[model samples]
Target: MKNTTDKQLLRRATAVHRDMLKQAEKFGVSASQYDVTKLLHTSESGKVKVLIDATERLAIAIAKRRRIIICEK
Candidate 1:
């Protein structure tokens, strides 16, 4: 049961990450080049922040599953 839920979460996160990349490309920038904080509108910034946070959390979860340590400075 837990494994199934994790798989679903992983799928969702992958989809979101792909979509974000596509959006950045539409703006003539790669996902790594896109700056979420530079958005002029507060709401848009907040929404992007939430998505980024979720994606980070998902990455951490995946790393843990593989017994990998993610060091943050």
Candidate 2:
């Protein structure tokens, strides 16, 4: 059961990461701007937390960029 739980967590993390990357691309944010190398060595829970934090940061950046673009127009 623990193994199954771990797998689920990993899957969720991967999905979140993929979505975050797609959103970043849409906003013209380079993937290289975020450091994900450490994720591989982190625990499953840690990976999720890190990814969630990164996603929130990306969302904020995208919002700011949109506001700037709207103001420029």
Candidate 3:
């Protein structure tokens, strides 16, 4: 199997984030564009995968009117 580059992983994560944002907006919330440097240096999997995952989870919480902290890069 080919190794997935960090950039590629981040791209995929961003797509997930975008979808999360749409859901979040319905709850009157939004997301921030995390700095590239922070993402690049993120401690998880050489990309911001966990961050996006957390964002998705946060969106779910937002939809349910639950309060959650966003982990910005």
- Candidate 3 C-alpha lDDT tens digits along 1-71: 13567667677776776677666666556445422334545465535656666665666667555343434
lDDT-based ranking: 2, 3, 1
TM-score for candidate 2, please give it: 0.66
lDDT (Cα, tens digit) per residue for candidate 1, span 1-73: 1467655664564477666556545544335533333442455223544556755654444445345332421
Clashing pairs in 3: none
Residues 6-73 of candidate 2 have per-residue lDDT tens digits of 66876786677778767778877775556463565655347666776776777777677778778989
CA deviation > 4 Å runs, candidate 3: 1-4, 30-46, 66-73
Better model by lDDT, 2 or 3? 2
Identify the candidate with maximal lDDT. Answer: 2
Q: What is the C-alpha local distance difference test score of each model?
A: 0.49, 0.68, 0.57
Worst-scoring 10-residue span by lDDT in model 2: 35-44
Native-to-model Cα distance after best TM-score fit, residue 40 in candidate 2, in Å: 2.3
